[model samples]
Target: MSITRLSDLADKAACPRLVVKVGSSLLVGPEGVRRSWLGELVEELAAARARGQDVIVVSSGAIALGAARLGLEKGGRGSLADAQAAAAVGQIALSSLWAEFFGTQGYPAAQLLLTLEDLEDRRRYLNATATLTRLLDAGAVPVINENDSVATQEIRFGDNDRLAARVAQAARASAVLLLSDVDGLYDRDPRDPAARLLPLVEGVTPEIHAMASGTSGSGMGSGGMTSKLQAAQIAELAGISLAIINGTYATPIARALATGTGTLFLPRRKAAARKAWLGGRLRLKGTLRVDPGAEAALTRGSSLLAKGIVGVEGSFERGDPVAIAGAEGRIVAHGLAEYDSRECARIMGHHTSAHADLLGYAPRSAVVHRDQLVLK
Candidate 1:
């Protein structure tokens, strides 16, 4: 569906669940937090909530706020420790501000700080999903952010854009609004006189991704057009639509939702809940290599048994997402592992009966239950 104007969005049915990601540059200023802009945004979100829509906000600005408080320069500077310290101090301020803003609008808000582990581990992922779902069900808005205070470069989401996409997938949101400095995608840099804005994106193809260039001009934000495109791709695969919109104006969230004044990236197709979860995984804890028989069984909707397993690669705990590969070393499916890597190695080629004697405890029979597996 091509959405070139805000009227296009108004003609369509209202989105049931929405995820809005606000950039640090939009929320933070050199003087301090932009209260007026934030209040407007909160009012817009509250209106959506009043209309019976679930709204979640993935906000950036902790580090920016912390930097401002410490009188440090923004952008890529200082050590990991310094960044962590800033995040620790800034997150408190950011959360408090959100609470106050949402409170004034008569909307309850909760803060969620997540790390990579929260999404990769099946147990934690489910827990987070349940919490978010409960909050939405209770008419509360969830204000989410990366747990930058504890996350390192290796474990962090790197940008709120991708984290918002992940959050959308987890929450099963119908749409995502990326509120940033840029209004929408362009054939070329929007700063150039010849550049043309792309109002609608059917998919994030290689050619489309190629159009993105440069970082977010704001020294406070980490993501640029490239990251937003990456986020759109992720959202598309999860059966969610994403839009990049200019958030400098008042009521940006309401405007984007009502008028579609942004580059709307449509989902490729609808995905089942299990398929969405499988496709949206950003990290795989390990890989389980199986024989031809096991691969065939998996294709036929059978559980991954230890008897047909050939190898276990990498270290992972129980309930962690793992890649299931076939004899040809191609990933055939993704599933939550019932056993750890070490246990799987020991039980490989063994029957379910032997699991008790080998592991000293009788756990589940299958390495990965059929219900938990999603084929690639």
Candidate 2:
């Protein structure tokens, strides 16, 4: 992997799809929601959308808003029930605020509350991906937040910074902007006079992780620099660039995109997280033997069509990882299967036009989409 660091942030030209994470400290306060700040932020996002960019916001303010409404302390030390109740109450207000603000800019905002479990389950992951894609295609901004009201301790992400990274992975975003309390990562405690911000991080290493200390935000927010570092690592591995910037000022997103006023974490590649996982980590549950024409098509970066599939082995369902073999049973690639084993058996050696007649319903055109395949 290339460890190429940058002295500045990657410009908007480099990121067509962006995820911006807003912390509670920036959105809520002792009184209530910071409407002016949120309005400004929405304006910046609207400018991005006008430029033909897909923008998603991962916001964290539900619990804080709820706590204030219920006369509870910020960053509650109460039982999980208290927090969940706060979340349940605050979620409506939070979503409403987002809708109200974005609506003023003539942008429709959609809410998506997800738990870590949703991303971990393969079927749900794909479904979430599809939903996000559809929302973006419809020219709406998705406002995502952790499902704090329903999440247990075991399933809770507890912080929006890491959640933003995971959301970037799911959305195939090109960059993630973590707009929090601090401007960027510092060499030491930011309170120290001698502390200096690191502008660009090529890779997240142990030494880099050591620089981050305890949480640095207001009591309303849960994540500290530690969670941000963890987020950077996640973004790096998934080939998505991430940046830490303070959103205390007006038009911070525009300034950061233009002037690189933050610490930017570079990705290992320009590829999406799905491709990276398919290429390396996932275990294969089955195999497909394809004809020589399909083997050549794969080498040329084409999708695997049913007409090229000669044999299917092992019992696997749709979205399961499977290996593709060519001549002499040599493995050529691995990918997520679009159809189950029985479906593959029925559709093998047939044209895509014949799929509906054989399967009783029209399915995906390719057995393995090029985006989901990793060539060996």
Candidate 3:
């Protein structure tokens, strides 16, 4: 909450705070961990570091990096266990490889492994933000990768594209550079003469989605134009700028950062959208009619207390999302109503401590807890 309004960030930083995600297709070539690619990336990243830019790399070459180094044929040629084993084995070498390359450039790199669960939970989310900030503060480029050796399909990020957006949000980055083999988002397959590259996107409109054709490039990755659009939407929602450009091009990222040459995705209309999406998590299962005083308190960003409930409507279970409304009929706040609708109805007009003996057992003190409530 103390972070800068992402929509208000300065245009492309003199020392840009960036979360750069590179897919496997661009990381490794027909041989493996293409020295040519890694060589170019290291020099550019090091230069950025020297200029005082903070960079966090959400890299995807791990699985492929692991597979190729382990001498496994294409990614599918191995079993799940085989893949995990390969990743476990390859990650060591992968980190060492990056560590040495970065060392050679007189910069230090830190390997930060993450899973989807790390970002989804609120407590873990805060902890992760703190850790990444501290790392960047200490001047270490965080080389983030999904903990693939243990992540199952159900708990997986599915692609680094989405992970990169989340990372950008966490880092409060000015932009997320999605470096792939393609130059930018195109109207059709760019390989075809009919396809056209879109230079700018205002918001993620349907037309923008239309231009997002399917996957193109070489890799064991499933991220296509569809996933890139998904990442773009995520970045937009967080009010972070994003660029999808070809990593294969020489000095691709440096050039984009210098002139905003790649496709520029404008930031979202933040305050309103943030109020709608990040502010509303639970579906309303019932309603609570509050007195004028409680309504005023809620408007000032206070939690809904037990004494506020004049009446509870409809059947809603504990932890179910509910709406708080005033006597004049307007929503005050959206919250997780603590007690079930039946129990809430029983204690509607009573204070929290007053309900214990009447029901033979004490229920939750507050009608709705603060942590469960999201202010409008």
Candidate 4:
């Protein structure tokens, strides 16, 4: 839970499953796609795969690469239309390049473009996780990036760093690596030459934050040390370990996982696949009323029961997160409903033993199974 311990975990992570998010700055430097760096990344990823690790890459640079290829001198700085157009073209070319690169190495890479809505919506989020799981199981690497073209503000992933964190939570990855231009976070701007790199950040205290100056330059990339830290915070909350390191360095991805060097953010508490999935999103669909005793039991980490349910409101089927409301109509927890709205209403206020007779259905578990619940 302490950043002090992050490095040790980084060193020992053996991290059977990993997620690496690459920034645009690392992809297209002052020149073009840093072929050497890209090669090192690919080789390292391949090596990890060979070592029995499943890896997913959240890549940025479709727009940058597309604009460069299209000879668009003014890209993102230009009109929105130009930016979207560049992203569309770049996404196609960029994905093709990745497919070809990984294919030659005998590992296939699949491109997945997600908008912010995918993570905000619980069902859609699960679908995305399922898709990625299938890819990892099939021994294919999933390359995720924001859908820059079609996505507007509502569904946009503001930055790839944020997207990367969400992806880590979605996949329940034990570790999340953020590859950028900066080597690591420094107490002051490293450019001053007098600044110093803080090796271990146990927690982003007020003093530590004061040390974080302006956005550290990332050349063509939107994220800086500050943004990476924010991503780390988000990833950490869901129990995903995070690292920010220099992407240009040879084998940066694999090396960081090997604890070569980086700023590591440790997970406060690692959640299981189901808990991680449920806890990551708090959006509620409906409400479930519980008695005072039921509230106590559920809050104490006990499973839900029909005996606890006083009522059900709104419309949501099985597996949907519904707010667990107390007698006073205050929400105490959010959990996946075991039955549909009508079914839950019928089973409400009844004891668990009577589920089969009243509902004429052989219920397997409680009203809201503990595994499906996310306590507030």
Quote the positional error of residue 246 for candidate 1 in Å.
0.3
Look at candidate 1 and give me any clashing residue pairs: 6-259
Q: lDDT-based ranking, best first?
A: 1, 2, 4, 3
lDDT of 3 by residue, 1-376 (tens): 2123222122334226878887777776677677766778888877767766788888876777777767786673267676776778767877887888888898788998888778755467667889999998988888888888987766778788888887777776767778877777877777789877777777777677877766645656768887888777767666677777768866666656555445767755443432333332223578889999888887676767767789888789997778888898766567777788888888877777878864678667588876666543
Candidate 4 on 193-283: residue-level lDDT in tens? 8987665665444476566654637557666666677676557657777777777778776565466466776655555666655554535
Per-residue lDDT tens digits of candidate 1, residues 1-376? 4333443333224467889899888998767889999998888778777767788999998888887777765432477877888888899999999999999988888999999779755678788899999998887899999999999988888898989998998898878888888789999888899999888888888699789975878867778999998788778777788888889998886666566567888876656766666756767889999999999999898999999999999999998889999999877888899999999999999999899999999769699998788766
Best by TM-score: 1
Question: Model 2: residues >4 Å from true position, as ranges?
Answer: 1-12, 74-77, 270-376
**TM-score, candidate number 2:** 0.71
Clashing pairs in 4: none
Candidate 1 to truth, TM: 0.76
After superposing candidate 4, which stretches have Cα over 4 Å from the reference?
A: 1-13, 203-208, 213-216, 254-259, 271-376
State every prediction's TM-score relative to the real structure. 0.76, 0.71, 0.71, 0.70
258-278: candidate 2 lDDT, tens digit per residue: 665678888654445566545
How many clashing residue pairs, candidate 1?
1
Task: Look at candidate 4 and tell me the lDDT of residue 40.
Answer: 72
